[model samples]
Target: MAIANESRQEEQNMREEHHGAGRYWLIWVLLLVLTAVTVVTGRIHIPTWGLVLALVVATTKGTLVLLYFMHLIDHRGANRLVFAVSILFVVLMLAIPLVDLGTRYRGATPPGSTVSDMQAIDIGADAMEGRFGGGLRKEGKTGEQSGSPRQ
Candidate 1:
């Protein structure tokens, strides 16, 4: 009876090892698929939707890696809590810059102005002739500056 019980326990352990390998393989395949999806989505230009789709795919892949590859799936309590907090901090870091950029005034300077020109304008200086060396200056006129033919 003791020998039989020991054999059964050994068999159960072997079965569990096989099952674990299978689960890891599945997760690996899933990660590969998500990577393909990411590459495909990255090529097509869908404006804001492209960014959103890429983020979703990346997040899915990341979660899979964290849960399975990192062996966090069977873990609970403190481990999960730490991971959740880390994710929160990452999101916060990304979001802060995006929020600042989104709220910036788009019309801060006139279009076609260079970085130095924008800086000069911000400091309340006449950057037009200063940077261009006082050439044949004409506003909204056809030439190298305006590109469009003069009316």
Candidate 2:
């Protein structure tokens, strides 16, 4: 009976070790396939959808790395909650700039209009030209100009 029990225990240990190795190998293959998919998708441009697809692939890869490589999948309760909160903060940081961009008025600045106001400065033009001197100084107009030799 003791011999049989020892043999069974050894078999069980072998099985467990095999199973763990197989699982890690499978995950490695899957990660490689995902990397190939990301490379393929990146090379083929599909306009707006291209960026979206790349982001999806990157997010999937990141999640896989976090779960398997970081050993977060085996963790429970508080560890999972902390990771979830961290993801939420990351999303919030990305979302705030997008929200600001989306809420901005498209027609706020018309093309080829030189009117100086809040809109002109916001649209990235030289709105404070008068205070900074509009153009090149005349040759003999001022005492500072008279000191310089004219070519």
Candidate 3:
């Protein structure tokens, strides 16, 4: 009888732990919408503010996942503080590298390239040539397909 009572208590605890399928479905939809917004912003390329917008969207999504999917919303205060600190560490790690990269001089060779025999090249031109379907390389700055007359 004691064993049966313990099993019943375990089942009751599990039932109380669940917030319900409705809440989960709602969160799922919100996450999807945020993902779509991120995709759109990435493609549009708003220049200076683009990276900031993307980071904001990513942080929001991460917070939602942590609070809901990870069950951190109802977790103990100590656990929440630990998670927050870990997130702060991660942000610091990423921010330091970004800051260093942004402040670096143009055309300066990156570290580890010195070990290689290869020399530096025009990164911007190469990237633009690839992205514009070879139009920039084949048709100058017009970006039109070669052998086709512009209307």
Candidate 4:
């Protein structure tokens, strides 16, 4: 059992050490070229094809970033599970805002209790008239001052 464990450890170490430098550099160059291509491709018109191509290219970029930068592909199940849950939470957050926006015209509260009803506009013909005397004033039949209620 001890000898088998040693062999397994040695094999793991060897696998970790054998990454190819030239292929890694080539991968970096490919990523850069693909990014440039995505940018340029956005400028041209392709009608129905453009949307599919854009999503495909975006997914490709996401995959590369996930595998290399996020290290998800190389990571074990727990790390990937964490990523999945995080993505799910973000989707949930986005969905809530969309629901709120969609329900704007739908009645949530009593109709007459909203903001506009709280402050009804002053219907007095005199825009400059104040109910109480600052500049323009209004008088009752007994000639008493009524304060500006229009504002």
List, in order, the clash count of every candidate structure. Answer: 0, 0, 0, 5
Clashing pairs for model 1 are none
Error of 2 at 72 (Å): 1.2
TM-score of each: 0.58, 0.54, 0.54, 0.41
Better of 2 and 3 by lDDT: 3
Alpha carbon lDDT of each predicted model: 0.68, 0.65, 0.75, 0.63
* Candidate with the greatest lDDT versus the true structure: 3
Q: List runs of model 4 lying over 4 Å from the truth.
A: 1-18, 83-151
Clashing residue pairs found in predicted model 2: none
Quick one: how many clashes does candidate 2 have?
A: 0
Worst 10 residues of 1 by lDDT: 115-124
| Tens-digit per-residue lDDT, 1-120, candidate 4 | 865776576668657865557755776787898888788888887765575677667767776777765545555545578878876776677568756754665344334444222444
Q: Residues 11-57, candidate 2, lDDT per residue (tens digit)?
A: 57655653366767877888889899888887887764675677667
Error of 3 at 110 (Å): 8.4
Better of 1 and 3 by TM-score: 1
- For model 3, the run of ten residues with the poorest summed lDDT: 109-118
Give the Å shift of residue 107 in candidate 1. Answer: 3.5
Give per-residue CA lDDT, model 3, range 79-111, as digits (tens): 688889988997898799878767666455464
